[model samples]
Target chain A: MNCRQARDLMSAYLDAALSPSLRQDFEEHLQECPACTAELGSLAEVVSLVRSLPEKPVPDGFHQLVMTAVAAAHPAPRAAKVPLWARFDFSRFGRVAWAAAALVIFFGLGLAAGRYLFPASAGSTAYVPPSVTAKPASYDATVATGGNTVTDTVAGIGRQVAYSAKMDLQVQDVRAAAAAVSSLAEQNGGYVEESKITTGWFGRVSAHVKLRVPQAKFQATVDQVGAQGKVISKEITAEDITASYVDVTSKLIALQTQEQQLLDLLRQTTSVDDIVKIQKELEDVRAQIEAIKAAIQNYDSLVAYSAVEVNLSRPLFPWLSVVWPGLGGP
Target chain B: MGPQSPENREALLVQRCQSGDLEAFGELIAPYEKKVYNLAYRMSRDAEEAKDLAQEAFVKAYLALPGFRGEASFATWLFRIVANVCTDALRKRRQQEVVSLGRQVETSDGEVMLELPDAGAGPSDVLEDLERQHAVERAVRSLPAEFRLVVVLRDIHGYSYEEIASIAGVNIGTVKSRLNRARQRLRELLQDGELFEPHNVYKTRAPSKGGAGR
Candidate 1:
């Protein structure tokens, strides 16, 4: 083997990738050639040094940091239990219960729409039964009271409903419209959640406000806000979450009960080991209770206060300038 | 409670992670964090960049866990993600110059001194070793991205050509050629500093039959 051949085969030789005959020839060449031998040695040292470079220790809390980031990106789904109604074997009820439930839902939605569209006129029919309205009355009571019969309530045990409305308006001034929305929400025992005002490409001002108004004032608030400007487009949505709400509420109650039991055990336990184990379990149960409570609270608030998203924009006058030169000025 | 095999443990952890257990994913990645960090550090030669790369790799792995089919070992899959992330970062940074080893600036007195460490600060032996390591690191950093990756994988991380090929998404022949060229370039850089000399070359004994190649 010549020096060139030895140099070409150097990495292969070091890796032991050369065949027997080729390896023999390479070794023979290495025996005769000091330059090839020295070159191979230097290369080997470099490779060895590279391999021996210390492994950099990962920073402290790296796992926690990674987990924190991952959690932020993909939050853990709520561990709410499936509601009894949702898990019910509806097949045994045949199509009668399903048809009756659907009819009640449809009637309930129509009554809700009537109350929203004509608040004064729809009051008599939309009024809740005194018995149901008197029970620990909260957001869920509002849904049950919305012209739904006792039979409807029984069928809708796991049902939750959230209302939201979006309105696009052409206003003389966006700031004024935004102020009116804030005032409307405040007057109705609600509040403005978020508001943003921006000037677009044509220097036309636009304002966006997210309002949370009591379900009772949802239609009124929409109407009041819509009056601020020329109505461009309006969309109202009602999402039924009775199943999810029931599931979350039930889970919260169960977790809270478990937490209380663990707390009781923690107090009565005499053994140190048992105390420690009970305490750990209590802590876990408490955490679950807190999460479930938060979910329930979220559902309650959403059902109690409907979300009103309003977009108000000032009209542009580019056409005025084109038709009559110098007629329009910023 | 009883000692479990690594494969079974890893499979269980992966299952948990796929089912949305973040804590399980954290445990699954504990063993490979240092290796992944080192890989990133060797690629970027910047501690902060390596941290970012390592974090991104883990996050991507976590997000993509549901799609992992166990076709490859978890380590292989993770390393592949790290390699791709590093490659993207290097590509984005391509417009910027690679860090030069001995950057020099003209002084007020027109004395062009090498921009290096002060020689009088430390013990000679310790300083020499540090300087040698620093030089090697810089030389590795200065290599083209492809060559640097192949060299780091094969020589430093001790991956076989086939593994490197899979990680790099290239054929084995490409891995072999890139590794050879990278080693040659490293030798040239060491020679330029007079750190590598032809004399005192030691020959290791050839491996016995059946133990030669990976």
Candidate 2:
């Protein structure tokens, strides 16, 4: 091999990447040419020095810093299941755009807050100011309210929203908090859907209760339960199911109409085969109508009764409590 | 009971992280933080920049963890993210003027010399080794970003050609060529320092009587 060829293969030779035959030829050339041998040795030494370079020590509290940043970037949700809507792609907009949009939403909601605050007046028709109604024709006002349902002219009855809340409470007495929550739910014509209480070693107590309360009394019940203890955290979510609700309700209506038409045809039909065919289609439509009705019923229940999850905890040793000293007294 | 294997532990942690457990993600990254920091330090040659790059890579990895399918080991996947992050940082840094290490230093007599770090009070052999190591480091740092990456992955980290190709998003042939060119450049740079000039045994010898002999 010429010096040029030997030089090209030197790195591969060092890496043991060359084929046996090529390696033999390269080794022979290296023995014959001291220049290539010395160059290879120098390369080897350089590689060795680089590999031996001491690793730079990581700065102290790196793990803590990383965890802090991670927590800030993604706060751990109390509920294990993250809502689908919460994961929406808000990253497509720049920060400035998001801020501007948020400002608009805040002012718009402030104007509409009075209407939403009084549940008794929810059925009353409120006048939408001309300025608010004068949006451009191209603008999709239905989408502005979120959900896919176009509620422009439809009655408010079609607008079904499910409300849920989660609250963490540091209570002086877990049992007392649990009883208060259950009593609040009962007072609102509701009940506890699920409850878990654990008393660990040293008499430390914690309770988790999932309460279902009347939608009209959701806020009142939450406030009363929250007043039972010091709330450490709270989250409230409203999910509009108007699109799915409207879709299923309309489908059920259409299927019912079809079923009636089939029944009329069944009465007039004389041939056995025609009767059988109509009856088969009638059965299918009836099944679909039943399924849609079940879905609407589910939505109705979810809308009628909101879910509230409350977590209450107390320290194991009363004297060990640093933050809640007054509550620490046995 | 026996301890859980790393693979099982990693899988469990990944599952928990997917479920929005940040603590589990922290545990998952504990073993790789140092490796990642070292890689970042080598790439940027700035400690502060390395920390930023490492932190950014971890944050990105966490956000993208939901989409991770575990097809490759987490380390390989994380290395790919680190490489991309470092590349972007270098590109941004390139927009500003960057002083190359070991460039010419002028003395009072206007004589040019290679810029080097101050040699601390050490024995001669130790000082010599330190100087040579610094020269080699500067040479590696002076290489083009692409060549420098491949060389670091291959020679320093001791990754296989295929693994380098995967992390670098290049084919094996590209990796091999880049590594070869990088080593050749390093040799040239070191020769200017006379670190390897004395070892070039054939430089004083005459040409062979038979040229290109088989």
Using DockQ, give the best candidate's number: 1
Q: How well does chain A score by TM in each candidate?
A: 0.50, 0.49
Error of 2 at B159 (Å): 1.4
Instruction: Name every residue pair that clashes in candidate 2.
Output: none
Candidate 2 Cα misplacement greater than 4 A, ranges: A75-330, B1-3, B100-123, B197-214
* Candidate 1 C-alpha lDDT tens digits along A1-330: 798778878887788877899999999999999999999998888888787777788865466456555755664454447898898886798788889989998997776566556555532222121211111113545322222122232244544678888877777768887888778889988999999999889787889899998887787787788778766667777777676665545444555566677888888889998998788667755665555556656777888889999888775674433332222232
TM-score of each: 0.51, 0.51
On the 0 to 100 scale, the lDDT of residue A83 in model 2 is 88
C-alpha positional error of residue A183 in candidate 1 after TM-score superposition, expressed in Å: 16
Question: Model 1, stretches more than 4 Å misplaced?
Answer: A75-330, B1-3, B102-123, B197-214
lDDT tens per residue, model 2, B40-140: 88888677678889999899899889998988888889898898898777767755755555565554446333453321222366866786677777777
Name the lDDT value of residue B42 in candidate 2. Answer: 80
Model 1: what TM-score?
Answer: 0.51
